[model samples]
Target: ADGARGLLAMRQAGARTIAQDEETCVVFGMPREAIELGAAEKVLPIEAIGIEALRMAGEPKEGIGSRGAA
Candidate 1:
């Protein structure tokens, strides 16, 4: 709850966020809290977090786009 409160504060101040998915989390509790509080804009696997952040920041790496494209 405390973490969610802090994330909410940052969010209200125009901060963007990414969160770890339950399957990828050792203690899904905290991340789950922030997610339920609407603090995260994207929730993804731990492996994908960095890639997603880079993409969000407009600095994507080569050969990583649409990882599972049809």
Candidate 2:
């Protein structure tokens, strides 16, 4: 559960977080714990997880979408 604890601590430190939803979880215990501890800002299905993670990482720092410099 160290990973979960670390994620919780990160969220407590004002970081954005996401967890897999119970329905999509193969093992719901870890995410359930994180949610109970207020670590996760949102829980989404696996299918949409990639999109959510990308959103959390924010728009690319320097890539195709990097301002009009491209």
Candidate 3:
């Protein structure tokens, strides 16, 4: 699948990566493949995904809060 392939390619290009755990995945095929291929650095459950991704994305490059009128 494209997700698995992309993960592999990204790893080959020196990028850290994460994948959803098989137990938490609706479609385990992709994540499973990525894990099997040694592309994923860690596999986390869906519930923890948001926080983990946010942490990785880092302290928001842009300023906090909305840009709309106060």
Candidate 4:
């Protein structure tokens, strides 16, 4: 709950925030809370989370078509 609130605050401060999707969670409490609080801009599966984060950070992903990719 506290972590969700912190993510909310970060979003309110204009940060790009993401939460893990419910289907992929072993414990959905935190991510569900964050989603309910409108903290996450994107809710993604666990496998894709790292790649999405890399994309958001402007890092190349070889053939993954992310930002800065050539």
Candidate 5:
């Protein structure tokens, strides 16, 4: 799978990777391959991926600004 290969390469190059869990993926092929290849640092539901990525990047969950702040 090209996607799996890319994810593997990224992981090997010191980039953190996330794979969509089978439960949430409409088609699990790519993510499954990445998971089996040990390329995914974190396997999560689709809804949680972006939040987790932001957390991993040390960015605030509130996003770039305080627009949502009251």
Candidate 6:
């Protein structure tokens, strides 16, 4: 429950969360736990993860599109 509690605290503090997509994860342990615990708000690929996080962090952006899409 430690990780859950920490995530809960962050949520209470109005913080958003992003987890690297399972496809990009080496060990889908903590992130999987967090996702199952209702912690992560967004799960994105490694390349998109940073942009997603920045977007949630209130960064102004031109736009966001799935980079993997062609």
Measured on C-alpha atoms, candidate 2 has an lDDT of 0.80
The true-versus-predicted C-alpha distance at residue 5 of model 4, in Å, is 0.7
Candidate no. 4 TM-score: 0.80
Q: Estimate each model's TM-score.
A: 0.76, 0.72, 0.70, 0.80, 0.79, 0.69
lDDT string for model 2 (28-67, tens) is 9999888887788888998988898888688443343446
Per-residue lDDT of 1-70 in model 4, one digit per residue for the tens?
A: 9999999999887677889999999999999999999999899999999998888778533445435646
Query: Across residues 1-70, which tens digit of lDDT does each residue of candidate 5 receive?
Result: 8889899999887777899999999999989999999999899999999999988787532333338547
Better of 2 and 3 by TM-score: 2
- lDDT (C-alpha) at residue 44 in model 4: 100
Ranking by lDDT: 4, 5, 1, 3, 2, 6
Supply candidate 6's per-residue lDDT for 70.
60
> Clashing pairs in model 4?
none
Better of 2 and 6 by TM-score: 2
TM-score quality measure for candidate 1: 0.76
Which portions of model 4 show Cα errors greater than 4 Å? 59-70
TM-score of 3: 0.70
Model 1 stretches with alpha carbons more than 4 Å out: 59-70
Model 1: colliding residue pairs: none
Look at candidate 6 and give me any clashing residue pairs: none
lDDT tens digits, residues 1-70, model 6? 5876688578556577776768989988878877877787778888998777767667532344225556
Q: lDDT of each model, Cα atoms only?
A: 0.83, 0.80, 0.81, 0.87, 0.87, 0.72
Model 3 collision count: 0
